[model samples]
Target: MKKIIAFLILTQSIISCSNSDDSADDNQISGGKYYAVGSTYGKNKDNNFTQLASVWIDGVPTILSNTASSSVANAVTFYNNDTYIVGTESLNNGNAILKIWKNNTGESLTDGNHTVEATDLTVNEGNVYISGNEFIGTLNSSIATIWKNGQAIRLSDKTSEANAIYVYNNDVYATGYKIIDDKKTAIVWKNGVETVLTSEQDDLESIATDIYVDANAIYVTGYLRNSFKSKAILWKNNSPATLSDENDFSQANALFVHNTDVYVVGCHIDTHQYDFVGKIWKNGTLVKEINGANPKSIIIKNNKIYTAGSGLDEKGMNDEGKIWESNLNNLDFIAKYKFPNNKVNAVLVK
Candidate 1:
């Protein structure tokens, strides 16, 4: 069934004007360090492999052109102070490619030859990290692995999948799930060390979608489910916390930590199956719904909150993409735009 989603304008303006006068064009178009997927010059959904791609501030999108012809970009993370951006790419054949772009030049970091599917991207210091699966010889049996600078480190080879990655103090953390003895179990890896965080329950499917690192701890958020519905969850030092009201199916996809406040973005499905209402959780409290849309990424700069994700139209069909920027101090929404859909995934303030 098609789903109907809404992108609402928070009538209240919480964004404030700052003393620093950065022109919109200068701030967004010139020497910008954010990451996104814009529509390739000529591609669409009918191509069976067409999707969003990464672009630079200079008005050019990062693409391999040859191997990733019909690839859809999932998410992007800027590393090394935005000097480098890393994300996942897929080919029309369904094989995934982990690609790295330097600046906005479209330079690649994949040795120019290899098949991969990157689910998440992150970096610490000068190191780039990716978590996803490595394809197995023409089969569906891909192995869960995390790559550091293109070097593959398998976390779980047990017919598993890795969806997210984070680096804290140079220690790598990857989360996903594995099939053990015909049961699904949630898993997390620290520096390639495997640790099972949740058991294999029949009705439970635990998947960690994002990771947040602070000076002292790591916070992970995703969804855990039984046979019927799922619930939003957070893991501190690998411990779980339920964030949904009873009977509400929810998920937290992207995470950001600004000082002592922790923010997460995703969607929640009410008991009536309201079709995954877009949601944000700030420091353990349900703040506001940007729209009936799902949030893919979030950022806080200069005390302003910005969110990027997508929503569905009234016809219950996924609509155009979006970006929401909060007023000063993030007291309310300042501006909302139908973000370009060429293949953008994530946004960064600096």
Candidate 2:
């Protein structure tokens, strides 16, 4: 199958302090140095629809990838005044080269002979850890992989992908899915040992997209899918707990834990996948349901709740990246900013 990329102009609106109080308040939304990682669509040199990996700082975007191929930023992290971004740059052959950017400079981890992607990353003691998958061309199968300082570590022998990574006490933890008997079973790996988070069911599929580990327990969030319904799930110490209601199907995209309180963000869709509404859950209870959107990342900084993701376009078929700010206590609206024609994947506040 051939991939068709979308082309759209991405524009940024710089908000700054002005004479009006409303303008100053709006500028305070992203007051400090803020970062959002994603991709923006534009026409490349060939006049073809393509994208460039970018990091948005205070609503202004700085492109990170070369124009040789289309690229995207899937995750972002900062450590000791250095910024790290992980994603992929596509080749004409449809293969992707896993790309990493440090402080707006980019490099390739792979040669682009086969497909490779990085969804999340972390920096511990100046060592870069990235979670992703690399396709084995001859076998046509993908393996869940972790890269430590540019060295690849495989977590599975079969089809699998790791979407999130966390390092605690120098122990590496990752979560995603492994294919079992043609079904997807959510899994976690601690120091390369596989731990199953869901039972393999022939008629059902499951995935663990995010993982967090502490002294208390291992926390993960994703979804279990059957034919007609999907449920947002949180796994604590390998035990499954659904976070969705009976009336709607849902998928948890990412989660954050603060002061022993688990905070999750995702989207709820109807059975037919028509209507969509963003939602937040606190400690297994529904805290708020946002506008129609899909939140990809959520975090709490300085007692403020910040979410970065995409909302449906006018046609409700495409995604337009946005950042939402709200009060952490009551989930009340504080501010919002939209990036035209961009798809945000991660956010970082400094």
- Superposition TM-score, candidate 2 onto the true structure: 0.87
What candidate 1 gets wrong by more than 4 Å, as runs, is 1-34, 38-41, 44-49, 56-67, 79-82, 88-94, 107-115, 137-139, 198-203, 270-274, 313-318, 328-331, 340-343
Tell me the lDDT of model 2 at 212.
79
Q: Model 2's lDDT to the true fold?
A: 0.74
Error of 1 at 83 (Å): 3.7
Q: How do the residues 1-350 of candidate 2 rate in per-residue lDDT, one tens digit apiece?
A: 01112110110000000000111111133335668888888765566777888889978888787465688888877666677788888887889999889988888898877898787887776678888888895787879999999999999989987878887777888888898878878889998999988643446588787887778888888888765567788888887788998556777778888777898887786534455688898999988887667677887778888887877765666768888898798898533777878878777676
- Model 2 clash pairs? none
Please report how far candidate 1 places residue 315 from its true position, in Å.
Answer: 8.2
RMSD score of candidate 2 (Å): 7.8
Residue 314, candidate 1: Cα error in Å is: 8.6
TM-score of each: 0.77, 0.87
